[model samples]
Target: MAGGRAPRVLILLCILHLHCLQGAKILTISFVGGSHYLLMDDISQILQDNGHDVRMFYQGYQNMQGYEKTSVPYAVSTYNMEEKYLKAYDELFHEYQREIFISRDRPQSLFPLMTLYAKHCRLYMNQTDILDFLKQENYDIAIVDPFNPCHFLIVEKLGIPYIAFFAGPFSYSLGNGLPSPPSYVPMYLSGFTDRMNFLERVINTFMYLGSYMVEIRNEEIFSGVIEEHFPPDSRPTLSDLYNKAELWIYNMDFSIEFPRPLLPHIQCISGLRAKPPKSLSQDLEDFIAESGDSGFILVTLGPIISAVYRMDFIKEMNSAFASVPQKIIWQFKVSQWPKDLKPAPNLRLLDWVNQNDLLGHPKIRLLVAHGGLNGLTEAVYHGVPVLGIPLFADQPDNIVRIKAKHMGEYIPFYEIKSDKFANMIQKLIKDKSYKMAAMKQSVIMRSRPFPPDQQLLGWVEHIIRSGGGGHLRPYSYQQPWYQQLLLDVILFIFSCVALLIYIIVKVIRFLIHLLYSRKKQKQN
Candidate 1:
């Protein structure tokens, strides 16, 4: 394996070296937390590894796990947010997540999240010193996490080109002018399959319209920040700034996701951070060995959702894991675990897990996840089936795709019980079909003509070399909705046809009246 990889490694370096300038300074922004920042961190590291002077600006709401300046190869700068914003974020999300989402009827969550991100935009713009420092960096281009529009606002202020980095399935491209036909394409968080029935299609259409409504609300949320920071005449509209991205790098792959139309400017670099399994620690290895032929299950509900893990939920999961023969390696922090409940005999709970590396283990039978894109992508790369218990945001929507692909099944959090949860786990592990499906998806994932890193390095350098990706973007981006969809032209044709028919009918009636009058006079 090492021998075969050497040539490909050298070729990749040569390809990247061709575009390598005298160390082009690249700036990356991460305004959101969790997997969003993780994706940017990996991207920044890749660029730095390829000899670019990469720097990451990290700030997040309420200091969630994975929000800290993680150990990465690139330089990182930090900005502290005010206590008021942190307090507000805590009060809002904790209550909302517990009360609304925990109820599990798919309540409206877009507006609340948007409102929080908008507040962060205001907070980000208030950092005059950071803005001035960024202006002096003179970066060739910036990579913005479009999750928070403020990330782009900073890049716009610096007056450099930027690429939008989407962390997948949150439907950022829809409002940013991707051609999403509602008939078959499902909206983010709608939880409908790509192949939809008539009722599903109707709901999908409304969900598409709801996306526009969300965008409008998002604009309203951020209008204050733009007004306060940018000058009147020089102010940029939200749509223009969103569409201004030279390229879009999505954390999505067609193998796991439904096939959809994408532009040349858009690229999928899913599972770019994945690596083969490393040797497990002695204790963990011993535990896996005890499971013997059954292997083990890896479970993580993400950092945010795990913090809210209820004791009853943990007990139920524990009972289910006990019922299974497969040893469970669950990523549960011991500090937050309830004193009343003990872990099952077959399970081992760890505070921190090397998830990607663990997924690639030789004996990894299944992954039990919260359906986050990062985890799911790793599962796809490792050819491991998943049993998703989705909670909030894109989690539910993501699991829908997972189940649709036949790699795994999902049990709604509110509906999870010991019996049903154990059955699903056994089905995913015992059934060879799910494993076969997962391996097939992995083949598709790895079958891309060029690896994701090459695609990233290649496209990023091409964009910088050409100053921007404006040439790659289609001309349809500049057209208004009426012209782009040809709605006005259709209306014009319809009206003209109607008018011609009306005129023809009127002419025929008049001729018939004249003929009748002539016939009456002759008869008299």
Candidate 2:
């Protein structure tokens, strides 16, 4: 009886072992902006909660403090960009910001800055310690933020299947080979809506082509970096690695994003970061209570922007806030406040605030933001209208979408006159339409088929269980450019028709000539 029981126990142990092995070992790569890190952290958290073993490799220039309490195991590498590269980056960032404010168009030259970042990422990945650690780790799948193309190569070198994780709306590079006709699906940086006139469509088409060319150039830059870090003979090309991705998870939703075609493997986990409103701090609560029926406004430009340094902008904002009846909570990051610049008595300045929590508060009437994706999503989640002060990158496009939805209005930084700013704020607060539209979008955004976390985890598990879901990848991705566009087929059909018409004309000419010759002979 003891021996029979031991045999049954062994069978039970084997079953337990199989169940444990079913849990995937996931590796996540995140870099650069705070927003990107936040999105990746959310994903890592969900993956780990579902019993998978998740590890992350994070490298960023700033905002490392945000991930201090994360449970997922991680190896962090900082570029130490502050020591040497900060000045250059600051100059570029502000310059680009100014350009966007003035022109409200895509920056003329982003390739230089892109290549600079690529070089830094390549340098970090080539470190002996990082390389060895990554090589030893056994991972079933890699979820990468493809903001830097170098990450794709890193996953490829480790011989793991990967999924592209974008922190914002699907851009041109990520949406490549996916059907996003420019006529309807606006270009990433074009700042156009889905509803476009003929001129806008023509511009969208050109912008699409231009963006593609830039991607090609950047790919070439990344290819050289790959060759330097890995063996040239056996390594795959950048395009090959890009096409090899098993899935794509975009931090976007149809509610806030333009409708476009997408592959089955692509998923949208838009408001995953949004949570139920938490109780405000004692001081915050007191401030809101003091405001009474007037409510309060929240102003933040996010992590990268140096809003404190822009004295002129600050003065204009101060003037505008002074005229308003509502109290204000401004997240300004300066050590010493300028004595000469007097803010409104109703304004309260702090170094940081829990933006999501503040947005959810019932007493908070308006959000003044840099039009970042995370901020916009949070505002939409809480049904709060925004007064957009767009600076650069996707900010313009975000504001355009807000206006189209009638959820808000935007004032470019360069055009921020005190009266105009004040009036916009007043319009947002007094008008019920903006609030109604925001609530409508919030409803749509929250009405996902499944909770965002569950959706994210389910898709990730699907990829691992299905062995990278290679069958879901579009065949068009593997085809030549002409063939994928059907230009070759169109050309073939046109040639055949032209040849048939030519042959008919020749036959008719010959018959007419013969008849004319016979008639002349009969006359003779």
Candidate 3:
């Protein structure tokens, strides 16, 4: 009996230990462009390395080193190339892009594109082949970037846990309030700026108002697509979509982000940047060594912003580099440099370059960029001050925040003249404020209690440790903006005060009239 009891206890202990080991199949869908995949790849790699199985879905290849990737079932090729819908999509994309470039504050402008993107994502999710694959694979949780909101919704509908990877500084991760960052007014305690100048607060309020409207419209558009594709019974209401979000891993650091509101289910695990390769190419090494100590500025507009679109700016940049003592390293994808433009002694241009490693080096002094979130992260990670030449989309918002933090300077893409560019570079290079601000942010980023990659793993594993989507519910989106702000209470009190004033005035008039009449009669 004693020997049997000892064996039973040992078996029970083993079972408990096995139960504690959290190993689940994580399905990730990354259907956006190269920059979006940067965020996706980081999270997926972290999960896979931490004893979890990951199946990654991708539309395009950006980071192609050594990661397992499964192609999205139907990408751009499968779509019927009907002129009307294609034109409609193109027009919408252009309009949105234009709005992002010129608008003073347009946080919700991306919703229209997001809805169109969601429609295509749903189209792919509908195919019979995908249905078959879905039925065969057993997944525990599906982590998707919010840009591909439909896939996450599908995971939620399946009663599996789903998480969103925030690619930039958007408030979508802050809950169902809106897709923009928290109101830029009164500056959240942990915001990048110390105080909102009058103009900035006004702009922030406009953004808040605009974001509310956009979220309402996006919900309608998002729900309509689901209703059109899936049966009424199969789809969840907009409320259900936000509620199913088990965790949101933000690719932002607290130093750069405003103070976050409480959403117990939401988790912030930002600064998950891709690490640079161990060594640099010979050409790059030679260029770094030849710069003669003063170092250089790395100018890039990322992979999406074609050099052709930015050729004029490059001309200005070339003119600017002519005067500066510092050398310049440009990540040029195009083959042709303008005929009139002569390559300077201190200038070098490469088709493709390692941006992160370049920024990390002690030789690189300033970064002139298009202000994509990835580039911003890199500049901050290396404590390099920047001159933001924002193009479109979130670039404007990113630059504004970048400028607000005093970490860099910003110039509109079209307005960058050679003289202006050169002068700006000279100011940034000579001034210590910009460098100090960047270094401060970098320290804050590094000082986080846990590494961002590890933090992401912990939050993901926590979701698995708990049950999937069961912990988070969808009641947060129920109230409208007016009600949430208690505008009704203000209206009610104002109405009561007005009514009381009217009643008092009427009573006083009546009393005066009666007294006048009585006095007149007595005199008569």
Q: List the residue pairs that clash in candidate 1.
A: none
Query: What is candidate 1's lDDT per residue for 349-437, written digit by digit as tens?
Result: 78778898889898899999999898999999999999998887778888989899899999877778999899989988899999999
Tens-place lDDT digits, model 3, residues 1-524: 99989999999986885465456777777766467876776677777777777777655433232233454322221224346655766677656544544554344556677777766666656665644565457777778877656666556545556787778665553344433343432221122342667676676666555655655776777776677766767777555566557766666666665554545556666667734425777877787787777788898876434423445756777788988988788876545566666776778877666778888888889999988788888788789899997766567667777787788999877788988889999899889999999999888887889888788877777777666644554354556668766899999999999999999999999999999999999999
Best by lDDT: 1
- Once fitted onto the true fold, the runs of candidate 1 whose alpha carbons sit more than 4 angstroms away are 1-22, 60-70, 105-107, 506-524
How far is 226's C-alpha from truth in model 3 (Å)? 0.9
Model 2 lDDT tens row, 502-523: 9999999999999999999999
Superposed model 3: Cα runs more than 4 Å off: 1-22, 61-112, 157-159, 173-175, 178-194, 197-203, 274-277, 307-311, 336-345, 469-524
* TM per prediction: 0.91, 0.90, 0.78
Q: Which of 1 and 2 is ahead in lDDT?
A: 1
In model 3, the clashing pairs are none
Ten consecutive residues with minimal summed lDDT in candidate 1?
A: 60-69
Q: Clashes per prediction?
A: 0, 0, 0
